[model samples]
Structures are given as structure tokens and as C-alpha cells.
Target: MLRRVDSWTRTLRHAKPSSSESVRLVVERLSHEGRGVVRPGGKVGFVAGALPGESIEARLVERHRRFDEYRLLDVVEASPRRVTPACPIVERCGGCDLQHLDHDAQLDHKTAVLRELMSRTAGLEPAVPEAPLRSPPFGYRRRARLAWHVPRRGAPRLGFRQAGSREIVALAACPVLDPVLASLPGRLQPVLASLRRPRQLGHVELTVSESGDGRPWPVLYLHLVEALAAEDRARVAGFAAAEGAYLYLGLADQRAECVYRPEPQAPGYLLPESGLRLTFEPGDFLQGNAAVNRAMVRRVVEWLSGDGVRRVVDAFCGLGNFALPLAAAGLAVEGYEGDAALVDRARRNAADLGLDDRARFSVRDLDADAGLPDGVDAVLLDPPRTGAAALAAALAARPVPVVAYVSCAPATLTRDAAVLAGAGYRLERLAAVDMFPQTAHIEAMALFTR
Candidate 1:
């Protein structure tokens, strides 16, 4: 009877497809994260690297009660919008998604996602969605954080984390990064491997700032679990000197100490259009794509440049990216940020530009009931991903004539848009900003007015 029962169990197992089994599926659409959505056996499945309207064979990697996860094995039918990914390890690298999709289609996808969220969540839609703010699909990223790991055995690995994994995908080059930053990983690999305690080095962040002559001024921040030896420090300094890159050593306390500097001045980027230059220290929040940031700043100034708009409030302002420019555009701007360090930096930047009288920076906790400043004609907010629900509620109570919201997450943006709508603010203009290309991430600018 036991043998008979075992035989029946075997038969039942073969009756249906099991986990890790390959199955053919037709992708219905792309999820917000750029994963292809499908339904197999009446269960939703998310398959990475599978385009919408394509038939593909995928292996079930994970099974959950509501949805399944799949790894693409073969594409039986490919979408016309698909293209060969530029990165050889795009499949495994977590740095970028939607690389296989055409660049134009990527913009369309982002706009569609934004519209869907606004219509569904906010119950509002723009009369006309503005064209997406464009950026070069490749070599546009000005900043990158790479993970470095020294395995128990084998050469030390340095690159981005693997997709959906903590494992590091060692890279020789990354095309999406700025040209100067793209080559650093390969060159730094050997230097990191030479360290006495390589595993002590947790990660490295690379940022590229352009000099006045259009030369790349690269900065490297080395995050360490423990202090490096004098010899190791010297070796890393030697590499920085050779590359003409500024170096900062991040200690266990999360303080970055400048170890090497080729110039007396701190590294920063210029908004030539605004005739302003802003300097920032290591770990400061900066927009990754400089060109897009400039365009974004310009758009913000233009959108707020209406008659009778004399004073503006910039919330969650970091180093005065928008406030300084607005002041340059002849508006009195009050910039508020949570980080005291950033607030100080913004003030210094304003002073350097001689816009201190017009632009003032204050350190305020936006998460709390930090009421909006009075006598401000317009409000501009660029909140982090948690998305200014508290601030949105505050804005609902005290509605401004115009509110420009810069959002990185559409879901949260729509959630806040609902609050503004309740306060009788109509969605005026909405545009997708291609701030980070070759990725599923979306940045949007929305204008709301009473």
C-alpha cells in the first residue's frame, strides 16, 4: 500500500507543471518596474527581460500565493520595440532595466505609467501630457555606486549587485555611466584587490563633475568597514593622483574625510544657463544626470515665471538646485531642507552667487508640521521617494496659487496629487523627465494650480 501511494504521488506531481519547470507564456504588458506581466494557470507572473505582446519560454524561479516570478529562457516572439542591450551583462546587472526596449519606447512607457497612475489614483489627468524631457540614452549617468566584494576564494569582485540578488556582478565596463566613470571600475579593481583588507572596503561611489573647460573632474568616495592601513591609503591615493580624481575615505562613522584633492576648491557642477555654480561635499544629494538636471531647473524657472509670481517656496531643497536658479531668475526663494548640512551648503552657494538677499536656506523637518512660509506666490517641492504625504496634507490646508512637484516615484506622486486635487488644485502640466535612462525608474514634473 505504501508503494501504491508513492506511485500515486509521482503521478500527481507529473500531472501539473511544477516550480523550476519551463513554460511558454504570452506577455500581456509591462509592469511598473519594466517586468513583463503574464498569467499562467490563472496566476499572475512577472518575467524580467520579456517584452509585452511577446511569447517567451521562462522558468519559474519563485512561486507565491498571488503571483509567480519567472526568468526568461527564450523569446519565441519578440516585440518590434525590442533592441539588443548595450551592456553584455544587462541580464544579470541590477544597474539598468529596460535597456532592451527601444529608447523612444522607454520614454513612452514612462509617460504611460505616469498617466495611468494619475488617472487611477488621483482621478485627474492633464489636458495634454508634455513631451518627455530627453537625455542621451547612454553615457548620461553622472553618478554610480558600485559594490566590491572579496570572495573567500577567487579574484576580488567589483561592480553592481546582481539582479534581485546581493551577489555582485563583476564588470569590466558599464556603458550607461559617464565616460570618465565607466572606466574606473576596471582600473580600480586591481587597486582594490591589492589592499591588505579588501573585504573591509564595502562600496565605492563615483561622481563626475565637469570643469570649466569641459574636462571631467571625477570624485571617488571609498566606504570602508574599518580604517585602512597607512600603506593601503597611500596606494589608493597614488591611484587618485594618477587619475587626477579627488578621493574621500568614508570611515565607520559615515564621515567622509578628504584624502586627496588636486584642487583647492570643492568639486561641483555649473548651471551655465543660470550663471551659477554649486559646490557639494561627498554624500550630498545631487541629481545623477547633469544635463537633465539643467533642463529640469530651466523648466522649473520657466513654469514659475508667471506674472505676479514674485516669491517662491522650495521644499526639500538640496544645495539649492532649484532655489538658486529661481533667485537668479529674479525671484525671492525660500529654500527648506531637512539636512542641516545641505541647508548650509545651499546658503553658501547662494552667498557665492551673490543671491543671498533673494534666496535664503533654512533647515526644517518637512515630515513634521513645518507650516508653509507666508507670502509665497508659488511652491516647488522635490521630495524623496517616501513622497511628501505630510507636506501634501499641509499644502491642502494652505493652497498656493501654483505648486510644482518634482517626483521620482509616480505612485507616490499620484497619491499626493489626490490631496492637492481635494484642495481644488487642477493638474495643469505633467511631463516625464528622462533623468535616469536605461532604467525602469521614472522622474516626473507636475504643475498644479488653483
Candidate 2:
């Protein structure tokens, strides 16, 4: 996918402003990364902070022989889908990309991207489900890690890193975060900067529970590169008690020490339809959007148990997040995961839910699996970003009746889909959900049948 660029292009990298010429071009479309695509002087131009169907005047910021990067100065004409961004510093905060576009339009764009990736990468065109899966476009993210940057000459900055750079951009609040967690940056600004060991402080992470009452309660993680001073620890503990949210201090080795609370609170979110509550720790991996996650699990169980599936294999299952719900639907499920801690939590969750006999989770390396689990008639895979390539190959050789794969990367999903296709599995149903809105990323689900 990577091609060699000619050395000749490097000479005219960033044209000096005095010598640089601004070009007026109509925004043609959006790149996979959500940048505006255009053609200026017959060269491919990518302009960030610009939307499709917008005419903009941009100066050349960086140039390559294949594509040129432009900095948008003025929008001569704007698209009807364009809307004012919700966050004041959204353009610079580097947290979100599509905040300026309509929420519905963002969903449409995600679906299109998935469709395009499938066709281009897998040579298949699968139908998207009629019922679109998505959550609220804003204030849906349950977790956020803010970068802390201190300057020798000026005030410290606490926010996300600048767009495409390591420099931090100060922020008052982030709309994408759950409001309870969103208020941390603004509230902790003074407190963090005033700490005795400011240089030792790394960053702050906010995690929250999706309380079914439509409110979020948070627990903060204070990541530290060095040891925290006793005085600073006391202040953080006071801040934690005052804020009514527990604080945890983490070291470089991933080992953590609690400040206010002795243990990190494992927040549980209720999957109302399945009558299940999924609990996860502060650093545990859970879907970012609570509403959409519940929807996704609902959809998965619906697909898994629709045909009266007897036994299903849940690969790469983490903390019984998916397997528990499916088992609650009265299906026999065997869940496999790589993380021993997550495997323990999954088994504990199964026992606590009184579904231990129906749902069992064990530690297994999915990447190295030689074959599908014995006795399972159907399969459900919720793989990480790297995807289930080897597992897909294994499944391909030994065909199963049904396979439902949830993926975070479309390219990887399709690459695995091709293997399934070669083994006579039909790509039956595919859908894209905006689990993470305002960003270019999309979460997808696909059903395959032999």
C-alpha cells in the first residue's frame, strides 16, 4: 500500500508564505482519514478542517510527489451539511474530526467508508442492515486520557495533543466525553499545575459508568512517570473525595496505586434488553459509547440466537462482555481470550450471573489457535484492531454453520472475509455503527453463513 515517492518532490516541501500561492478549489470528497479531497494544479490535495462540497482557498503546507497537503484559510462556499462545531477548541484540540459536520451525515460517511473498504479490499459488496446502529454524536465517550504538557516559560497546558503533533492544546472542556468526565480538564487544570512534582506527572485518564439513569459517574486515573510526593498524594486524595470520584495513580509498568480508594471501582453498565450488567475496571477495554455498545450486544445476541443456535464459540471474548449477554439469551457459549485476568473476570462474571454452566470463558491465544473449538456449531468473534486473520483461516478450512464477526477495522475485517469467501462462506449481513462519532474510525459487524 505504500509507494516510493520521488526525491524531487522533497525540494518544494512547505512553501514560504511570501512565495506560496493560495488556490481556490472545490472540495471533491472526503479521504478515508476525513480530510477534504481536492485537485489543485492536477495534484491530489488533502485539506483538513474542510468538508465536502465546500469551496476553499488553501495554501500549500506540505507537498509530496503523490499528494499535497493544504491548509484551509477561507471557505468560499460551504456544504449544507456543515454545522458549527460544538467544542470551542475542537479544531485545535485534536479530539474530533467531524464535529463540524451534521451527526447524521457523519453516520452516512462511516457507512460509505465501510462499504468502500469492503469492495476495494475484499472484492465484495455486502448489504448494510436497514436498522442503523449508532449512539448520540456527543457526550457519549465514557473514557478519555488527557495529555499534560508543562512549559518552562509559560503556563502548563492540559488537554489533547495538537492535531497531528505532540504539542498540547489547552482546553476548557470536551463535548465528546461524558459530561461528568468532560469537566475534569477544566477542574483539574489548577490542581494539576500546582502539584509539587509537576514534572513527574504524566497525564490524567477519566473513566465513567453508564448509569442507566442517563447520567455518568466517573473515576479518575492519574498516570505518573515518577513517584508522587506525599503532599501531592494527599492533595489528590482530597480532590478525589471532594469530587466524589475515586483517583488511581498508575506507573510506567502499568502497576497502579490508589490515592483515595484502596481499589479501583469496577463500574457496571446494564444491558437492559439482555438483563445483564457488564463490569469493567478503570483500564479495562469497553466500548466507548454505552448506548451503541448495548445496541451492538443486542444485535449480536439477536443474530446468534435467531436460528435457535445451540452452541456458539466466542473468540477473543473480553470480560464476558458479549458472551454473558448471549448466554443470558439461553444459548450455550464457550468464550476464549488471551488475557488471563480478563479470562478470570469472564468466568467470575459467568458464575455470578448463574450462567457458569451455559457460558464458560478460558484463556487461549486466538492468534495461535490451530482450529475451531470442538462441539460449537456456530462462531462469534469480536477481535481487536489487529483482527482475527489466523482464526479466520482456521474457520475457513473447517466451515461452521454460522459466523458473526465484530470488527474495529474494516480493512482487516475484509481481509479475513476474503478467506471466508474462499471457503464458501457467504457474506450475508454487514453493518457500520458510529460507536465513535466525530472521528474517522468506524465499528462494523458482519454475519457470514455457509
Predicted model with the maximum lDDT? 1
Q: State each model's CA lDDT, in order.
A: 0.87, 0.80
**Model 2 lDDT at residue 419:** 88
The TM-score between candidate 2 and the true structure equals: 0.91
User: What C-alpha root-mean-square deviation, in Å, does candidate 1 show against the real structure?
Assistant: 6.3
lDDT over C-alpha atoms for residue 242 of model 2: 82
Compute the lDDT for candidate 2: 0.80
Q: What is the per-residue lDDT of model 1 for residues 1-450, given as tens digits with 9 covering 90 to 100?
A: 110001011111212344756788999999998889999888999887778998887777766789977767777878999888888787677777788899999999999999999999999989768999999999998898988889889999999877656789888889988998888889999999998888779899999876655567889999998889999999999999999999999976676999998777788888989887788988899999999999999999999999989999999999999999999999999999999989999999998889999999988998985598788799998999989898889889988899999998888999999999999999999999999988889999999998
* Candidate 2 lDDT for residue 87: 77
lDDT over C-alpha atoms for residue 330 of model 2 = 88
Clashing pairs in 2: none
- Decoy 1 TM-score against native: 0.93
- In candidate 1, how many clashes are counted? 0
Candidate 1 wrong stretches, greater than 4 Å? 1-17
lDDT by residue for model 2 (358-394), tens? 9988789988874776777789989988999988999
